[model samples]
Target: MADHVLDRPPEGAAADWTIAQDWSAYSAADHETWDILFARQQQQLPGRAAKAFLRGLEVLRLSKPGIPDFAELNDRLHAATGWQVVAVPGLVPDEVFFDHLAHRRFVAGNFIRRRDQLDYLQEPDVFHDVFGHVPMLADPVFADYMQAYGEGGLRSLGFGALDKLARLYWYTVEFGLVREEGGIRLFGSGIVSSHGESRFALDDPSPHRVAFDLERVMRTRYRIDDYQQVYFVIDSFEDLLRQTIETDFAPLYGRLAALPDLGPADLLPGDVLITRGTQTYASERAGG
Candidate 1:
């Protein structure tokens, strides 16, 4: 099956614009795909993923086989963090997506990926959107951060700073790491969802993991097609919220405009370095 894209609602469509989720449209193979990804990630995430994410699995009862019903999940989610999942045809417009988040509704794509595309899927499907993301939303601190990000996203759109703001989401929401008593653990949805990236991110000694700094992160660029060359680690979700909430990014963007971007693997004198990656994997890939 091809990837799904969000379409504009038809005239006189419901005010909220949610499509009736075609639950039965899902084939056994699709359910199997969800099952495969779920089981694999569950087995791989024990020590690597943050404790909150794991607890969310049990709280949300995500261990059950097959795709989860948004209605059922919403009951638990709404009660826990006042966040509910809403099904969209696929990726919504930036404004729409932000509006949903700002209101504490996470817009998720209802479809699952085909089995052949297991290792890497280009677009986020139900498994990626729900399994990878929703669990983290159950955590209060993380939940607040997402809502704030949504409001910030809307502000950024108006200021033509969406790209800069997006880097914040990518670094923190998607691929961030956090310092735990056990050492660095995965919190970012992008890393927690993948079997290979999860292992590569933590166990492999290839990427630079530095403390989270808003300005530095906004100035940095990330690779979309491969593993990150650098990962920013946070002390706690509270630390993440406090830093971003207290910051007024308009001035920060001005400073960033005057500076050069850091290469994915480049190290800086100011960075509080966790590990200076050897860059072996990235070098080998470039040669190949």
Candidate 2:
């Protein structure tokens, strides 16, 4: 998840880079902030978020109140999918991240965003990490895919293909869309967590929507600073899991090493195009 790796854990963090969530430390204002963000997403996500994600929100009872205490949240998440959320100071080293995921542990930052920064945050906060991602982990299929991805990540490190592998996580986990009920829906954390992106991802005509292709996703470059110019859509979580677990990535990594990286919006003749965007948004942003 992090863009770069750190040499070691920071102060107060365990060797695994985990810190106590200390739920009691949050102030009343903090709870209010969490409520604000939670309420907004709940209002915006209806008919927009993936069905699995919405189901997760209901099953976890994330609506109960303020910031979720890891102790309580884990009780529900673990029972549902054997996944637990662990607290990290911020982004951990890549290995530390993958290790946590491989073991079905998700690391989330302990802090929530300031009220004024609600619309955007460069680093993920609890709201973004938990409200955005943890719900999806509650799904059995997506949970399996996450763990498989983590195990794959370890092997990727040995091949020095982490960059390529990271693209898979970025495109699928962070900014992915899924085909459902005859349309594309938001399944990616990056879109589901943002008020603006939740709308733009499905309603806007400025971005390309392509069918998910494993090798294609691995070779594509993604932008971290703005709305995604392209999104990869999967048929279903079952298919996504089957594709991840059945594929032999060793050779794929070798092939990817020799290929040139593609820009986020690049279109190929072989691609299964859903939306051939005008790139109007990106062009306007760049022009401005």
Candidate 3:
């Protein structure tokens, strides 16, 4: 899962949700944890992750055997997408988060997960932020989508529609999939970040892999506490970008305000179902 923005910025900081990375302060264990997690995911992502993501790993030098030095990493990242990574203590507030995105800056959590908690952590840590999220920023199309999402996020707030916009983020940025030439592959950072979910999201028969639709995605709820019960599939990154950027969200948001919502497990007649998932995961979780 991704970390939300923390409510308070540090005392006297110029920007919200940003703090110095203190890159030199990390211990040997911290870097070791990053390496282990990085190696595990590196081994795991090849066939499952988006090719753009893999290329990003190399371009960013994420497999360098330690938590990345942000200054060093930024040199390459900025060259690629005009995006730079910044450090945050944990989650930051929404407005601050959108503001960063609008400006093309990514906020990352500075700490690494514990050895025992390597498989899972309650909040996103360094590996999750850098390994999971940063690579995609290397891709121009995905980079544009993120910045647009950030701009849309700020606009959505005025409409009292952050929840709707957040669902779009959940389905697209956090848990999205795309149909590649041979088959569907993972693009969403949430799935790419987790070993179990990376496989489960593709191989498991329990979730719908439906074609992405703007309104259906916005009104739909998502599962953050478990493997996603549904994943939206896009034809290409351009398809995702064009849809969001071209749409007049003001009217679309107004239209969607009155519509009934869907659950993580629910599918509608209008949904373009790619997998028509068996949803055994949800049933098993509920002990049905």
Which number leads on TM-score? 2
Better of 2 and 3 by lDDT: 2
Worst-scoring 10-residue span by lDDT in model 1: 1-10
lDDT of 3 by residue, 1-288 (tens): 235444466674546757888999999999998888778788888888989899999999887878899999999999999999999877888888898999999989898888998777878888888888899999999999999999988888899888888999999888989988779989888888887889998998888889999999999998767888889999999889999899999999898888988888788898888999998888898895
Off by over 4 Å in 3: 1-6
Quick one: best lDDT, which candidate?
A: 2
Residue 24 CA displacement from its true place in model 3, Å = 1.2
**TM-score of each model, in listed order:** 0.94, 0.98, 0.96
Whole-model alpha-carbon lDDT for candidate 2:
0.93
- Candidate 1 per-residue lDDT, tens place, 1-288, comes to 122254566454345556655677888888888999999999899988999899889889999888998888989999889999988766567777788889998977788888888888878889989999999999999999999999888877777777678789999999999998859999898899888899988878889888888888988888888899999999999999998799987887778778988777877789999988887889889999
Ranking by lDDT: 2, 3, 1
Error at 50, model 1, angstroms? 0.3
The global C-alpha lDDT for each of the candidates, from Candidate 1 onward, is 0.86, 0.93, 0.88
- For candidate 2, the TM-score is 0.98
